[model samples]
Target: MRFLNFPFLVYENILKHLEPRELLLFSFCSLKTRTLVSRMRHTPTYTIFILDKPEKMSYGFVEKPEKEQILLSWTWKKIAMESENLDNRTRLKLKDVLLDCRVTFHRKLNIPTLVCRCEDVSSRKRFATALHSHMCEVFHVKPEMQFKLSLDYMDELPYTNTVRDVTFLQSSVNSTVADEFFEKFHVTRALFSKRCVPDRLLKHSCKFLEIKNLFVDWSPWLDITLLLKVKCENIMFSSSTSVANDAHLIMDNFNLEAWDPEVDKIEYDEPVHDYCEELLYFLYDIKKYMLRSGILRRQSDGSRALDKTGSYCSS
Candidate 1:
């Protein structure tokens, strides 16, 4: 029992030393330990997908001292769902610990990339609401805490139940729906604060719009261009149909250059809401000025022109 006399910080550090997977199991043994582990895991962790590596080397091989240039070891985070084995007492303890940990270590929680595949918009919205409610309650915070909740969706719409901030939704569903959803739900100015509007939108209004990235591929979106400026890192036009052929004439459409990520300070338009200064940059913007220049001439011999008018704007 004397060991229990040690400071909670000591216990926390010990748990921090455990592998992430191990922490999940270790959390079950006691109320205090579970709390410590939960606090340690709140901050978002990151993972970078690597497409190419040396054929003969494993990460361990690269780390071996024999190799002069060692590749950095990689780490990532995974979220956990409720497990039924824990009794209500243990469950309550775990939840309490997580709540306390979230507040005590607010800056440490990892922003998670939520992979949602729900086809129903209502279901997705419900999920966001549930996620928002649980986190806010667990942290004993207000709805504002939802801003800190960052997510990334793989092949899923950004709006499931509703549109929330800082969540990335990637999907093959028609871009038309995504465009409409953002117009209906997301705050354009709040988006601008994070520099969320892309240049294509800026060119539309001829004002400085901040965006990290933006995408529009259908007609209804054109209606909201006035409200949809983003200072995004990337701007994508999935289908030019959104802007009528004549409208495209007046509008400076986004190209690969639209993909370049925006780098700027955060600023919000409203008085009550808050914003986060991103501690890191994860996505890259790709700009495609040439493709938007309206010149479609190719060489007679089937080779792309070696040179054409360079980008008219700066990324």
Candidate 2:
């Protein structure tokens, strides 16, 4: 009678109540239970990278820097994965957790494509380079197969002789932090000739390569220009800041007289209101508040804002 089948939910509840070690043993009770209960939990995909701060290098030690610059702080933020099927609620939670943790760069940084929440230059570079290497070794996703790659932030290092199109999710045109990035990543037309980037990044790419956040400077006209650039055809640059009215902007901007009007109209009629508007707004707003306070400033105007309508403001 003890072996009679229990309701799936009842068995699942039993498994949940067990300890980790006990749960493993509990699974062996029935093959049906094993499969059902095992798959119930959400195991978030986490890419463990090396902790960068000089102190973190010493394994368990913490180092104090010569200057107390909060911007210099680093951490190991979560990188979005192609395989993870995280729901929107879970994704937002992950972003929150990552903002509080220190950003860590992976040891061997050149994964063809990376999706990280890290905002630091050294940390971002390290994560990309190390991820590239890891992908090559583990998943066999080599640079040769990397026809498109998007970095949340661009590092100053040269490509590993195999990458094609590089995209950065930059948040500003000029900031003290931007200087550190420019110093590291060169963006002469010779290196990354064409880019999957916005116009602001294009200007910086003339001298340095960095990606701009869509929310930081959202514009429908700009998005169309970026879409037509050919370099960014397959790029995903929509961020929350531009979600409100950017789609209309994209449609209006891309709707040309030369191309078939009906086809253009069809494309324009696509349903992306929520995808482009609310989600992006949520993503960008949370990120802006969590990362650092205050927007990058412009020396000429001395304004303290990050919107397209105003000049940059320093903290």
Candidate 3:
């Protein structure tokens, strides 16, 4: 094509003006185009967001506006029927897997997107991994992956330990599925959930844990033992019923020596109950007891105190 014949610096400037979707489409034209696109000096960092149900993967800059993003979706429905209807669609080979790729505007979002339909369920993981690796190479960015997973689709888990953040959607998951999921994936940054996540999974250390909408109607899904078992740097509980009893339990049984050293903070935001007063009291008593026993020493500020675990217990 005439566009490909342009001077190297000339076309490089032109490629910089194209949006992510356009750049990706141009890269698919030929090997030289792909190389040229990859060689661009200023490439936007992309985060891969994966959804299990209605399985699809989307890539875009998290800070950018919604319309600027590009989505690559996969669907299993009407494969035989749709393939025959579209004449412009082509098969793009990603490693060993061949994807039936077509460019179409998203129905609801109305943004240009590449829709790929894999041949079988077994090939989905391979296709996703290949696409992730290809984008990383083409964009010269490290993978920053996130997943919004449904327990119903546990069999479709992403590449293990590659995901940075994971949000578990509410689903009736069996023990077997839960075990397999925890065994396969280890969340690095955070875990967010609105369901009764398995206790075994909570034992995995993460940077943040946020649980929402789980304590409605005084559900016993969350308790002191479970809270103590969570090995996270920070824990946030929101939209829950009163956790006054749980707070009391922490005061009684919380052991600095046995507690996970990684745990630095725990936050609670309850609509029905405000336990800040109780938490303050609990921290005060713990500080007094620790000071009496020399487990904690007061600083010159007379406000902050550090425990033997090197964690600040501030009131």
Candidate 4:
């Protein structure tokens, strides 16, 4: 009997037992199948992530049960499969575009991944974008997408709405490129960078901000002032050296009265230093000021400002 000939209950039961990848492939069978799969109650919501270097899209849950969290990955590379079974290979159509895909296990992630070998880079980008749109519609989930890419692939930047968080993986980014990127995409959620970010980029507001090994452009005071202008709920700053000095600078400039009320946590890390008395005093001073100004309600639990031995956390 044809698969669609089955009753609705039987169809749902079969879908419930199928893996995420299999269900995804089944959705491509026809419009009827796609709607059925999409309306099913057992469908999983995923956080979609896109990378440009190898040109891949990965989707997974953010929570625990790490084994089953990462359901599937799609890439344009021609990866060799562990099993040579011909059944693992198939061709799927995404709207007008047809893709040749093979089921394979990711060596490092230990998750099922689909590999599609496109003719060239342009075709790969089109396929990835089309598939991403298809998944978003079929899954009926809010666009919670993250993009990790190097500056070299700036020409291939995706639509602005599809990118909520951005991580620049380039070793170094010039001011011009950084200015162009910020001008193009206004990332609203989080911004992460390992390289030095220009002051203009730092002025943009986000929900979360994290920078590693950040060097002061002019001085620590100027850097702190720029960071203060960013309206974020949570902030983390780390440096390999001069961390203590940075902490002091932050304490001096971080005015709780002027801080965004939405902000709840602030953390700073320096690998080389322990909890110094001066740092503790600065933290206490901030806490006392917050208490006197009625900015902080809880006075007894002030230890959270300098919570760790080597790091500072204020909540």
Candidate 5:
């Protein structure tokens, strides 16, 4: 059909009703048709996976809350699966089909454009690194898409740069993998659950080492310097015994004097009983020291810091 021969408004109206998979096919008809499809405004809000295996290629999708249906090709050309039912693997120049999908969608769609999902076949497992490397060399994959790993691979990952966001299967990985991932990606926002923060996180001084936010089980063995380096803010942990020691460490080298009072906020899960008493005695002289140089006023340190009856500020 001569799709481009229609009136401009009519062509657009027709194109808007078509799903992304349909638009992809429309784009392949001709360069002119592809250009028209690319310029369309409405974007589909659906996720589609084009499954390809050594012998068959199939695809499927789910519109928002619907269950994703998997479809397979019985015969490539005789009884090919429709776009409404595509799922994984490697048929066609998959890299090109994927690139064209991105192009026709004008690079905006609910679905993350798949480069290669062909990890393994029914009874045959292809070399993953070789396949993925070839895809990277040929196609341009957007870094924003999440790479849902079968497991947080223990060995060194090859295409680290392409993986921006990662989701690990539960009980399938350990802190070592998470640590390695953080060290490599240096992703600004990161989360680690059910695992202890590893030593690799503390020792590295990489520019990417500035972890803006982190969530992990607190261990007393953790070095206090790591918290300072990670720039953790307002996070509460229940190590009552270590607060006094940590308070002293903070006062000595964490440069609490230079920190902006209005901006920096720190919280402890434990009460301020032992920590307050210990910190007050430690700070009494340091407060006097800061005031002696005229950096802090003596009146500011007068009774509030020295008083033992009140809450945080004594006097």
Candidate 6:
């Protein structure tokens, strides 16, 4: 059967019925076939968002971009959701996969976070490289695949020319693992959970990073000023009561020593509960600043507009 000669509408219907993997395979048959596939309204519709974990390889397909997320998991045993950790998205017990090494949300293009169970470094490298090559060929895409590695398994990283983005999730096992992973693969971002992110890793991770976005959660007492040395475009912190005390809304703005954040690209959600007079002063000042900055501008409906310069405030 000459699939190339099929009527465009017929091809569309057939393509629509194909599974995500089959669609990917069909897209790369020939030049004419590729063009026909690309012209079918949704060119790169079905994409694998997260495809990791060793024995229990977790993979998924996306029919709709953001709202509709369908997860397809493969395991030696049936999977089940057993518990929850509401305070932290990262801390959420995503199944009982314990041997999994690294969990990173690569900031390069916001790649899907991987929960990998590949323990041996050599096995991890081979599996990751094979999968990366296969996916890139199937999707007709460049090598922008992202993988997260820690100091423990740093020696296992493959030296292939795959455009790899590695993010080191600061772990409690040992915070000083940057030395093991940073020199090998391209380590881009670091997600901080607690206060024990060793001084060396924090200091070294940013020194050679090409791109950085710092994510801090439940680390209210984290020294905001230390970030000054770290070159980053954006910093995100989730305010929550931790061991140190109340979330002080730490940011580059905190170092500015002003009641207001004084920067356009800042995001602040109203504190879960008020901390003290200092917190009140901080919020009031930012509110006044936001109003004064955008009160003159009007939305399509003539309401005062904000976020012109990246100041996103939620009550």
Highest TM-score model number: 3
Give the range of the ten consecutive residues with the poorest summed lDDT in model 6.
296-305
lDDT of candidate 5 over 211-244, digit per residue (tens): 4333333334344433443442212221213324
Instruction: Please list the C-alpha lDDT of all candidates, in the order they appear.
Output: 0.29, 0.31, 0.50, 0.51, 0.35, 0.38
Ranking of all candidate structures by their lDDT, best first: 4, 3, 6, 5, 2, 1
Instruction: Report the C-alpha lDDT of model 2 over 1-315, residue by residue, as the tens digit.
Output: 243378767766776675432433334345554455446562322111222222221111011111111112233335543443332212111111212232233445311112234454554444335433433333233233121112322342323443222223324443344444445443221122122334454443332323221122232333323332233111233233432344564344332123222332211111122113433343345435442222322233332222222111111
- TM-score of predicted model 1? 0.30
Q: Per-residue lDDT of 1-315 in model 6, one digit per residue for the tens?
A: 498678878878888786654554355355566555555544343323232232443333333212223222322333232355222222212112122333333355333343443344444445445544444444444445443323443444444633223334344333345543444444343322223344445453433323344444334333423333344433434333231221243321222122234543334332212112233344356556443223211122222212222221111
Model 1 C-alpha lDDT per residue in residues 130-196, reported as the tens digit of each score: 4334333332223431121111222222223322232222222333433443444443322321223
Q: Name the lDDT value of residue 53 in candidate 1.
A: 23
Which residue runs does candidate 5 get wrong by more than 4 Å? 1-5, 18-33, 42-90, 94-150, 153-171, 179-225, 231-245, 255-315
Which stretches of model 2 miss by more than 4 angstroms? 1-131, 142-159, 162-167, 170-315
Alpha-carbon shift of residue 123 in model 4 (angstroms): 2.8
Q: Candidate 4 — which residues are off by over 4 angstroms? A: 42-46, 52-56, 61-68, 78-91, 100-114, 149-157, 167-179, 194-229, 240-315
Clash-forming residue pairs, model 6 = none
lDDT of 5: 0.35
Candidate 1 segments exceeding 4 Å error? 1-10, 20-31, 38-172, 183-315
Worst 10 residues of 1 by lDDT: 55-64
The residue-by-residue lDDT of candidate 4 on 250-314, one tens digit each, is 56554333333346333444311121223434444555545222122222333222222222223
lDDT of 3 at 216: 18
lDDT of 1: 0.29
How many steric clashes does model 5 contain?
Answer: 16
Mark the 10 consecutive residues where model 4 has the least summed lDDT. 212-221
lDDT for model 6 comes to 0.38
Candidate number that wins on TM-score, 2 or 6:
6
lDDT (Cα) of model 3: 0.50
